[model samples]
Target chain A: MDEIIRTENLSKQYGELLAVSDMSLNVRKGEIYGFLGLNGAGKTTTIRMLLGMIRPTSGSAFIDGKRVFADNHELWKIIGSLVEIPYSYPNLTVYENLEIILRLRFISDKGSINRVIDKLKLSSYRNIKARNLSLGNAQRLGLAKALIHNPEILILDEPTNGLDPAGIYEIRELLKVMAEKLGVTIFISSHILGEISRFATRIGIIHEGRLIQEVDTSQLDKLCRKRLLIDARDKQAVYSSLMQSGYSLSETKDGRFELLDEKAVRNPEVIATLMVHAGCPPTLLHVEEEDLESYFLRTIGIKEDLR
Target chain B: MKNIKATLLPEFVKLRRSGIFWITIIIFIIIPLMMGLMMFVAKNPAIAAKLGLVGTKSSLFGRNDWPGFMGLLLQSLASIGYIGFGFVTSWVFGREFSDRTLKDILALPVTRSSIVISKFIVIVIWCILLILVLFSTGLLMGWLLDIPGLSVQLFLRFSEKYFITSFLTILICTPVAFFACYGRGIIAPIGFLIISLVMAQFAGLIGLGPYFPWAIPGVYTAPAGTEGMQLFLSSYVILALTCILGFAGTIAWWRYADHY
Candidate 1:
């Protein structure tokens, strides 16, 4: 399918509160579509709607052109998902948990369970009950279940909620490989924008129950705001000198001068030379690009309001 | 139909591995054993006197005959079955919510309705096996203790009443499963179990046991034509309605509700 996963103005409401509002997006086959939002930004709600765990109040979601609904069991045969924190039957072993998924998926390969176990590197803990496995292992087990069938499309909501730094990195790399080499289409949601940006092919930032921005990962670096920051001895004098040189400088409350001018940031060496010649040589002069987290917040109007 | 078979394997695996299931089995075994102990005590007063409080409780059985023993078995199945069967239904359904695994099953290749039907199937198997355990243990204890009135006719009558009581008790579990899903955890369903038990007692006392869904099972097992314990064909109709509502409600909730 050209658009393996698509939503058309999907909305969910509870009484007066709108959990997801008129949200629409599409993920091409083999693309890792990152869904970024702050806590309670309707990421899970949207995922749930896509999975048909909850019905949309206003619009619809479709997987492989089939409209999602609880009874549309055929659509889920090739789709795998992990929504929110992953949970299994606590008493069942990790192998048994994945075995359950395999059975439900109706895959006849008895050895596929072991293959996923090896794929997730859970061989040692295969026989460990779900309750005894650490949070990271539990997460791996969840991913293992999602990938056991080698689905064409995978939908995950905060799949790395309880993983350590190493675990997160490993999972990110694994997801990248799955999408790049295996040609799996992944739709993953997370509050951590920076992490999702690392591997997501395209990203949609949601805020206040609405999708505010969608951008290609290749273009994300350019979309992040950048500024030329200048700080020197006699800062007021340096600010005055920059103003004298026809630099459109804005003094920040932190006593540093900032320049949003594209030219200044592009040629920062020229600004240093200009500052030294103007009798206030810069002690600190560098370009500051906004991090993904701040860019995410700004895109959502949370960080922008502060400025 | 194929989807149900697929869903059933996981349900059975989960049930098989749970500690609670074994505990339930042990409880089933122990109830009948305790009843047999009471039968033994009633047969021998000298041994009863030496037992003190145990003897006092055993005296509550009223007779040492096969009929009296069957009476105890029927009554115990009603009350204990209420708690036991309800618990099995609760754990089968509620563990999904308590453990937060409900979401994983919802969007599967198997339909939610199939998942629900599979769980009910497991509960049915669990209730039926438990009754068999109780009955088998009761027979063994009766043979070992050699209680009087051990005719084939008595055995057939008691077995038939026991099976019917067990069936009714299992029927009531449908609502328990509904409560488990509606309430979304073991605690809530168990709470509902307790409330129904209390309500059964109240309804039974007011001569309305035949009408209340929870009371109907207990009324059905009320000692083979006991004057006050009359169950009309209408009683089965009411109980059937409760089961239908509970079953349909549970399935609908799974299909339609926003299970966050």
Candidate 2:
């Protein structure tokens, strides 16, 4: 598998604070790689370094076999990026904004410009100046500008930030289309974990300026921590039965029991039977699976004080 | 050439939208027409004889032709226009950073040098158009006045003098061009013009005004043939230094200055 983006000991510092510290990662070609992190987790700093917007303090990154900052001219030709907030000339209309960029790219072909406009569904709003457009529309325009050059690699930081549900869905579909149909490698930084789970084929989680883990999306099931939650007639009997069975269990305030051990809590019905034999269960026996949220929390080593 | 074209197309489009081009034409045409009307008002024999315009001063002030007055007006306008050029040049780069258009511009495949060079080219073009409009205005006003053989002579002579004068303005205005790019606000560039003026005045007091960038315009305005080639050469030297400094300042800022 060819790595489209590779960082070797890449680090960034602002005065005494380390934004990204000795971090390294690889993004394979033709994959939607999710860069997941909390607020101020150095995702933007890493992306800035990758795009050659900010120089790394200690190390380096490469895109398509060229050093990022050293060979920016060559690297920029293949990579399109939207760093933080997307910005363009406020006075220029959507068409005018794109027209200026198209002219700058030396692409005078009217057909090609029209094609990008149509692809982004910005045809009707083409004449409207960017300042008058709402945030969602501006975001679409930003995405349109990034896609205008048709670069093979996209480094989009918080691409879906501040978007409505429909706009978010549209962006998700656009990313899917770009990755699946166009074979463009997408490196996205987003706080929307559910959307990232749905869209990303590979995810790298960063915390405290370090990459904690990189996992395949399919293995997310194994990464999940499911619970065999038991709600039985006899709460004490159910707890004692599960505890004697060597299953790690936790109790909730509402007289329910939580089986924390993943391997030990496989068969909820068998536990229910064992409770019945022990004269406990006459009503409910349920199992609930852990979601990506819990998995991320665990991977980041944050203990859930579910009190 | 392709890079120049790529850069120029956007700048031309910007000028068109900003209405700076049409505005220049209107001001150039209107200023002279107003002077011609004033000339008509002051044409009576008693008024003309009062200013001692009846004899040798005719070549300098003209009997009835507005070209001479228009030339004088343009000299003032050109000096002022020199500062205007700085504002326009500054806006070319300043607006990009202030309004956050630099990101879109840098993301394109064009080199960074092209962006800066193209704006410099546009400022130079604006200077050329300004000279043309002023000259044409003088010619039109001269035709209206019917100054007995003074029409064509004043038109050509004043045009030639203003043409030479505008070059010195371009040179003296070069530092303002650099200042415009470096300054973040409208007041900063205006402050630069003030500083340039002060520096030129001080230099003049010390007998070094000929070498200062701000003194080039006044150098050309030094009544034709008094100093002639000496004035031209001295102004040219200062202009060369201004160009070198402008280019150096522009390249340095474009490469390293971060847009906040």
Candidate 3:
């Protein structure tokens, strides 16, 4: 019951291509588990398996301690999902599209459609046909459909694909509140690491159809490499001074001296004092931590420069 | 039953909003009107001669009376129904793939089996409405033309054969549903439909119409005692089996296949 969603060695193969390979992961109750991967990195495939939209080549996925399968209608009762680019019956109005989901989800309250529309800020476009709505509004309609039932678990795949910055922020805040206030378990996949890192309690990075890393969002700072960058009026003198002092250093492309030594990064004041004493006071002496994007790329065995 | 209703309601809503629904209605009505016009021309040889090729083609009905008109309508149902009903079936099932909405319904609280069954039910109901439109319009047109030889017995017999022929034609649409899922779009099922229509013609020409599901409905429309057009009990059995297989195959694909 604590583990709202679990996948055990779940994989999918399409002839010679392995779409998902031995992917084992879990999302606990009220936790926003952000699944991160590059495009074609099996994020959607894994999500499809998790939702029982596609069968796994091996292993299984479970929700609320029940196995996932097509006929397990009961299992889908507590789950609301938006997979990939969400689409609806093009000719149906946004209200009608959500109504279809409301009925199909077996909700007795007819007012649920209006409530979700209002919540997703789709009230203005309620009468607009799905095909006629702009990409941002279409995405909102998709989210409204997923949220119409107010299920306990939500599986969203790139749910913010076509949203404007404001729209993205609104959706992110809504998801955060859902997870925090209502205890809704969210399993979200996105290629946007910085965005996911903001609200996700835990993050799993998938690459080449395999999950390569899983770390708490809070621990990302520790996991990501940090360095002290120093630029001075007298660069050669400062470089010599740092090397003579036995501090490991490297040169950045912008001609700044980088010190990866923990002592230099943790106690930048010490490096500053050294620079002052060496007759080459630092113009820029700042400790810079590797961002989530860089860390993700590095974890996937790809150089940041290459990316 | 609740789940079926839940799934069926959406199917009807989608169908109602689609332009194709009204387009099919107009096509059905126009077909009977065209048939009526042809009957009127055949009834007047002087006008028929002045009309040229269309006049000569109207003679294919064999007579200008009510019986000839009813017979042509039944035959038209067999062939046109295959295309019309098949189009409805293709749109019902194939639009899910073409519109990229299949994934939205795959893991819903309502079972996939219920969704598939509801689609078929919608197709059946829609196709039946088209049949009624064709039959009613044909009746109106015949009355307006006053081609003569109208009798109560003949009307009842035509009604019976027309409905049976419509049912047989609709039954074969299940395979089109299967192809829609298998091919994942409308084009494949329609391709399958056209090819089957051609094959049905060849099957009837080769005296094997009774054994072919698509040809059986056409054979049923032929006048009784017509050589090589007679239907056996086995013909009904063959059509029923093909229908059951297609229905089961569609449900199986919905339940077991890995939908992307």
Write the number of the candidate with greater lDDT, choosing between 1 and 2. Answer: 1
Give the CAPRI class of candidate 1.
high
DockQ for candidate 1, please give it.
0.82
Poorest stretch of ten by lDDT in candidate 1 chain A: A298-307
RMSD of each: 1.8, 5.1, 1.8
Question: Which number leads on lDDT?
Answer: 3
Per-residue lDDT of candidate 2, residues A1-307 (tens digit): 3999999999988889998998899988889999998888899889877876567889999888778762255467667777667776777788887888788877767666677778877889999988888877787788877878788999998887768998788889989998999999999997656779898999999988999899998888887766767777667877787788777778778867777665646776677778888888747566676778777876777846332
Residue A165 error, candidate 2, Å? 2.9
Per-candidate Cα lDDT values, in order, are 0.90, 0.73, 0.92
Per-model TM-score, in order, reads 0.96, 0.81, 0.96
User: What is the fnat score of candidate 1?
Assistant: 0.86
Expressed as tens digits, the lDDT of each residue in A9-81 for candidate 1 is 9999989999999999999999999999989999999999999988899999989999999899889888989
Q: What TM-score does model 1 achieve against the real structure?
A: 0.96
Worst lDDT window (10 residues) for model 2 chain B?
B54-63
User: What's the CA error at residue B66 for candidate 3, in Å?
Assistant: 1.6
Model 3, A1-307: lDDT tens digits are 7998999999899999998999999889999999999999999999888888888999999999999987888888888899988998899999889888888988889899889998999989989899999988889988888888898999999999999999999999999999999999999999989999998999999999999999999999898898888899998999899899999888888888888889898999999999999999999988888887888888898865311
Residue pairs in candidate 2 whose N, alpha carbon or C atoms collide under 3 angstroms: none
Q: Candidate 1, residues B28-109: lDDT per residue as tens digits? A: 9999888888899989999999999999998988889888998888999999988999999999999899999998888788
Cα displacement (Å) at residue B183, model 3: 1.3
Candidate 1: clashing pairs of residues: none
- TM-score of decoy 3: 0.96
What DockQ does each listed candidate score? 0.82, 0.32, 0.89
